[model samples]
Target: MRASLIQIAVDPDESVDSRRRRAAALVREQSGADLVVLPELWPTGAFAYDLFAAEAEPLVGGPTYEVMAEAAADAGVWLHAGSIVERGAGFDGPLYNTSLVFSPAGELTRTYRKIHRFGFDKGEAVMMAAGAELVTVPLPEATLGLATCYDLRFPELFRGLVDAGADVLVIPAGWPERRRAHWTLLARARAVENQSYVLAVGTAGTHADVRQAGHSIAVDPWGEVLAEAGSGEQVLTVDLDLTGLGVTREQFPALKDRVLGLAEPRR
Candidate 1:
């Protein structure tokens, strides 16, 4: 399956409306790709926490959702439209960092609200509601496990997805440029441990106080990097074999050795 990861530049000067149109156009450009993925919160910069409230919209009728759905239909590809700042029922209620998936027919296939908020006490942790459930979406060639930025720090979540029959892990992140090494390391680790393909797509340029890490990457099941983009706005495309996931797992058989017994108390 061929996948295209769009590493968008979230400049502070760019308007939300302009970014939405640009993103949709980029998705449309990947007409031959089986899947197209975007970075996290491209419409409103992820670290632009103050704007979340004002920009939040309902998941069903949100502008990002509407534009991306049409883009997926036009491209005839499965599109992971990164994430959006979702406003729930009440305007005064907590918002969510929600990721959306659209099928080739422009139908909303699945949605995953980011489980781990980035900020510890302030920012998203305090403002947004955390998602409880893990989500996985089935494609024509592979089952995708959904995750967002901070969620990469949690290994148990990826393991759970693997156990749930996920062959590919799709992570949409808006990680800072300062921690680019960690981003690449964690992505590779997740793929190696889970024996699944990892497609980690991140943002580029600077947004307010944060400078995004734009090294969008695709790693195969064997922990080999297939494609990686520079710290700029570009589409990184790669052809991944979904069958290789099972082949690697069968050949290595390491995941099958997992033990879940309770740890013995010390001294």
Candidate 2:
């Protein structure tokens, strides 16, 4: 399957409306790709926590959904439109950081509200309600495990995804430049450990005084980096063989030896 990762340059100065149009144009350019992925919270910068409430929209009828659905249909590709500030229905609490996936025919296929919010006590943790479910998108070519920026740091989540029969792990991040090494390292680790392809799409440029680490990467099941983008706005496209996951896992068989019940949750 061919995938295009769009590393967008998010600027605090640019309006959300302008960025939405720009992102749609970019998605429309990838006509032949099987999948098109965008970075986390590209409409508004992830670090721009103050704007989350003001910009939050409903899941189905939001502006982001409208633009991305059309773009996906036009490009004839499965589009992972990345995380959004979701203003949910009947939600008296904070909004959710939700990820949306669109089918080739411009239909909303699946949604994953970010389970792990980054900031411990402040920012998203305080501003948004955490999601409880693990989500995976089932496509004809491959089953994709959905994850967001901070979710990459947790390996157990990826493990659970693999248990659910996911062969490709899709992560959309807005990681900071200071911790870029962690971003790259963790991505490869996840790929190697899970024995699945890791498609991590991150953002470029600066927002909220934090420079984004834009090394959007694609790692094979063997932990080899297939493609890595620089710290700029560009599309990183790579053709992947989904069948490699089974081959690698069958040869290694390390995942079968995993020990369960090692750590217990606190009461």
Candidate 3:
């Protein structure tokens, strides 16, 4: 299946509605691609905590979701509308970092509220609610494990996705420029350990004073870079071999050897 990971450079001045319009257009341009992904929180900056209240849209009943649904139908392909600031009734106020995926039919497949909220001593913790569940959205081509930026650091989550039958792991991030090396290393490490395709998409330029490194990548089951992008706006397309993945896993059998129980006392 053809996949297009769109590395968008969102303008700080652009309105949420305007940005959504442009993102929808980009999705249509990559019409032949089976899955087209966008960067995390393109409308509101990743560190723009203040905008959460202003831009927060409900999971189903909002302009952002509406746009994603429209784009998926228009392109006749699966659309992963990177993420939006999700505001809802279940929560006290709103959830800052959340992602949503739509099928070709525009059906809502998965909703992932970012489990690992990035504090880094700054203050994201004060802004959003963390998700409690791991999500894997199934498609005709492959089952996609959903995760936002910081969640990539947690190995258990990726393991859960693999156990949940995720063939392709999708991460939409607002990774900062300062820790870019960590981003690349972590992505490659996840692919190598999991033995599955990792499609990690991020944004270029600065957001809320934090500069992002836009080196989107698609690592194959063997941890080889199938496709990669620079620090700019680009769409990376790559083909994956799902069948070969099964063969590799069977040969290694590391997953079967994984210890799931509690640890023993130190000697």
Can you list the residue pairs that collide in candidate 3? none
lDDT of candidates 1 onward, in order: 0.93, 0.94, 0.87
Give me the displacement of residue 98 in model 3, in angstroms.
Answer: 1.5
- Considering TM-score, where higher is better, how would the candidates rank from best to worst? 1, 2, 3
- Evaluated at residue 266, the lDDT of candidate 1 is 95
- lDDT of candidate 3 vs native? 0.87
Each prediction's TM-score versus the true structure: 0.98, 0.96, 0.95
- Model 1: ten consecutive residues of lowest lDDT: 86-95
Write one digit per residue (lDDT tens) for candidate 3, span 112-223.
8888888875666767878889899888889999999899999889999999999899999999989999888999989989988999999987888888989999998778
Residue-level lDDT tens digits of model 2 in 1-267: 999999999988899999999999999999989999999999999989889988998999889999999999999999999989999886554699999999999999999999999988998888889988889999999999999999999899999999998889999999999999999999999999999999999999987999999999999999999999999998999999877777888899999998877888799
- The clash numbers for all candidates, in the given order, read 0, 0, 0
User: Which pairs clash (backbone N, Cα, C closer than 3 Å) in model 1?
Assistant: none
For candidate 2, the lDDT comes to 0.94
lDDT of 1 at 256: 90
Two-way TM-score contest, 1 vs 2, winner: 1
